[model samples]
Target: MPTPALAIVPLSRDDLPVDTVELARFMIGKYLVHDTPDGRTSGRVVETEAYPPGDAASHAFKGRRPHNGSMYLARGHAYVRLTYGLSYMLNMSAEAVDVGAGILFRAIEPLEGLPLMEARRPGVGLRDLARGPGRLTMALGIGQSFDGRDLCAGQGLWIGAIETAPMPVGVTTRIGLSRETDRPLRFFMPDSAFVSGPRKLLESF
Candidate 1:
């Protein structure tokens, strides 16, 4: 049976927080939706990591370049990029234009379009479908082409929200980073099984 579509309110630029760290925290419990010819896939954001302006771990730390120019766009825009030459990472541009900062979508709880996500990630369990940054993009079919796209546009790939109440949020340091690893910029839902990373991080955060 086809999955029933979920009702989501499209988020606007005004709905986004201007501060990078705040935006990262705000993303928790929000919904991410991708409309495609095949179908619509949606999930509830359960994890996020902030790369604020001037953070050495941030791509925009050195200043804006051609490839990372999208990160400098005004808040509520897509700044998709590829990492490890294998997976695509999806991010939301934060802060005003010319100020490079972003929030990386780390994980989400699958809410709609399970078949599509399963097809993209065969053999992956439902809890792990969008369990990490790379898996989240792959499961949602988001790619580099989405870079510079306005997420507030309410079409194609975009972030949305339902009327559900917020969940308990947890804080922890970012994972798999060499620099600035001590900063507690990562946020996630303490109760969500869909959230990725080590069991200790999930349990302790």
Candidate 2:
């Protein structure tokens, strides 16, 4: 007998299955890869927030619009959106088609193409590079053009296998929301240096 190698594969529709919170936890250790004109840039997912339909903080709660239409698509598509008319935020569609659910990528531990990421977002401190949703998208150069791209199928963007085991995730209430804020829909690696949000005793990143 021999030790088996880890299997690396793109996420399947079955992996997402219309459960926003489950999908949020599922992405904690996954990797996000983006291939741009500069090259391939990737990172290990660290923090995530789930948005199910009817939640006051969810973009889809009001129904699909031009900006958030990707949330209604099949699994593995990017739900890139402009937040507060400033930088973009990257999320991945999860659950069933037309179910209106998604997982917002709040932060990632940069594992590849550091220079490229830095060039996209200059002068940011190391720990602050991808420490927030807007910062994460900026660091990865994921913009409006990436909207609706099939992360598991299309070119230029997709998730990769986790390079490390990330277990015992910490759950917290979703951040910066005005309503439906009591739900513990946010999950993050216990102590990943790339995780973003308020200072907590358990995790700092």
Candidate 3:
């Protein structure tokens, strides 16, 4: 049997110039490939959240700091960090360096390397494998060690080509916890079982 072809593409900072909303939408269904020195794995993005500067909910809204300094370094950089000292969430710095904007990778559907993902998160159902920001990060082997790494040229990480199945768009308030509760900045593939949390309407907030 012929091997399945993977639509691989190396995304650079220049290709990510769109604003947070566009970036969030554009990333849907795209594969996030991580080529670690140890092995390789990938997942299709299903949900995302955008945050721009001056948005009270954004971590980098005020200014670059030692913790969020990566978001201000340059576009196409990984801004990964551990939340609640347990889960690791991944974000890509958007626009220019020090601009204080980013796209949070909220959920992913396991595409390639299911064994790897299952091994990373055993006993979890396939649908819930990478269905949350932190869980997906862990499934892809992302952690604070990947912080500040350039996704465009990182040895073990890069986003793959866009997928063909374009799922419908869904909007809602950001998930978990953030200072900007008033802004409905979260975007995801509506009706997709891969979405991380409970689906709520804007009025539910």
Candidate 4:
């Protein structure tokens, strides 16, 4: 049997914070929904990393190019990218128009369409389905085509929220970055088993 659908209310652009780091923190407990031909796969955002303007770890640090132009769009837009020449990572543009900054969605707790997520990632456990940035995108059927798409539209792929308030968010330094590694820019729900990364970070919670 399919899991019962949760009440996910669409969030508008006004709901998005203009500050990069604030947006990263704000995304926790929000829902990421993808409506595809296969089915609707949705999850609660569990982890995120902020790549603010001028952050060396950001792709836009050197300034926008053809590939990263999506990061320059106004807030609430998708900035999907293929990292390490392998998997795709999903990000939300976090600044005003023409400014390059974004929040990388690291993980999500599988909520709706469990069967669809399982099919996309065969043999993976439920908690591991979207435990990482790349895995999260794959599980939701997100790809490069989703880049620059407006998330505030509340159609297709969008960010939403439920009535329940979010738990306290924990802070930690971002993972797997050579530069700006000491910055405490990563945020996650401390109690959520769906959040990915080292166990030491969880100790902070």
Candidate 5:
């Protein structure tokens, strides 16, 4: 069975830093684990959106700006940013340095540290715990301090695999953006109740 991943086995640099489209789809069913002072929180990746190099919808499209410079680092690193000045958005840096490829983690099915998460987002339901990028970061206690942190390192945060069968991936175009809207880069696990956004037609994986 693919129980919640406990240990931190972050994705390798060589394995990652792949194209944004490929990594976005490939990350489905993988686990993102974070250890905080509250406790260890984890979840199965349920949704993601990809932003390739030169993508106008991407922060890295401008190339190594002060805010998005983390995206230019080695693969398997966190590129956390403060969004809307109210929430933190967590993105995984993929592709080689300077290529500016990244995958946004849109949602996750919470696996561990429910109490800690609940305490963080009080009055939130279980299924909606990490249903969006900002919410996921808040739920996992991830913040801007994590920018450029190595996910493969056995630090407070990491990404790892499950022990059982993988879930099917659903792919479609990226959402809520004006630029590169038709680029077919979003990926999600269809069966996950925690997924967000409109239910558009998806290509099966």
Candidate 6:
């Protein structure tokens, strides 16, 4: 029998709009596929945070550099980086050309190819496998190795289409950071057993 093909779609830069909030919400439940040179792995997005160009907390808020220049390249590119010299964090570039904005993947719920994920992060509990942003990156084999990769083309680790269920009620907050210190822009699936951390209840967006 012939090898089965995955229902993958090449997400073009144009497919992503400039609306950061909508992009964050839309990304919820979608499958984030990482096709590393070593192998292929994936997971379901359960949490995300949107950051605008001028936001004080955004990495590209001030300007672009060799480190974050990818965020200004264009949409649909992966803007990954190491956090605290420990774990990797995955991000999808957003906003129009010349505008540096992106969505931070805070957490994911392991879906398909989990055995591969567990093998990657041995000794981690199944429930805590992909809970944190850094943990998820490690679980999916996303590291400096996948930096600057094009997720839209499915050429590298890319986002795949999946049947998304209704979004759980969530709240917005000034994502976990010491900067900006005042923007309530974080979003997550409330009451989800897969949440990486505790849920915070806030009013207004």
Residue 86 of model 1 has an lDDT of 93
Across 117-160, the per-residue lDDT of candidate 4 in tens digits comes to: 99999999999999999999999999999998999998899999
TM-score: which candidate is best?
4
- Worst-scoring 10-residue span by lDDT in model 4: 196-205
RMSD of each: 2.2, 4.9, 3.2, 2.1, 2.9, 2.8
| Per-residue lDDT of model 5, residues 123-173, tens digit only | 999999999999999999888889989987855898887566766788888
Go through the candidates in order and give each one's C-alpha lDDT.
0.90, 0.80, 0.79, 0.91, 0.84, 0.74
- Weakest ten-residue segment in model 5 by summed lDDT: 1-10
Candidate 3, residue 29: Cα displacement in angstroms equals 1.5
User: Where in model 6 is the C-alpha error above 4 Å?
Assistant: 1-10, 36-39, 164-166, 203-205
Residue by residue across 1-205, what tens digits does model 6's lDDT show? 2221456455566666667767776677677877655566767677888887788778898798888876775677788988888888988887766678888888887866667888988988778888988988888888776766777786668886644457554656655688876666667777666776657767422
Q: In angstroms, how far off is 169's CA in candidate 4?
A: 0.5
Q: After superposing candidate 2, which stretches have Cα over 4 Å from the reference?
A: 1-8, 163-166, 199-205
lDDT of 6: 0.74
Error of 6 at 69 (Å): 0.7
Name model 5 segments beyond 4 Å from true. Answer: 1-9
TM-score of each: 0.94, 0.88, 0.88, 0.95, 0.92, 0.86
> How do the residues 15-78 of candidate 2 rate in per-residue lDDT, one tens digit apiece?
5556777788888888887767667777888899998767778889888788788999987789
Question: Which candidate order results from sorting by lDDT in descending order?
Answer: 4, 1, 5, 2, 3, 6
lDDT of 3 by residue, 1-205 (tens): 1232466677776777557767877787677888755567887788889887677777887788899988886777889988889899999887676588898999987877777889999999899889988889878988888888888883578875653655667778887664877677788777678998767755311
How many Å off is the CA of 57 in candidate 3? Answer: 1.4
Candidate 3 C-alpha error for residue 110, in Å? 0.5
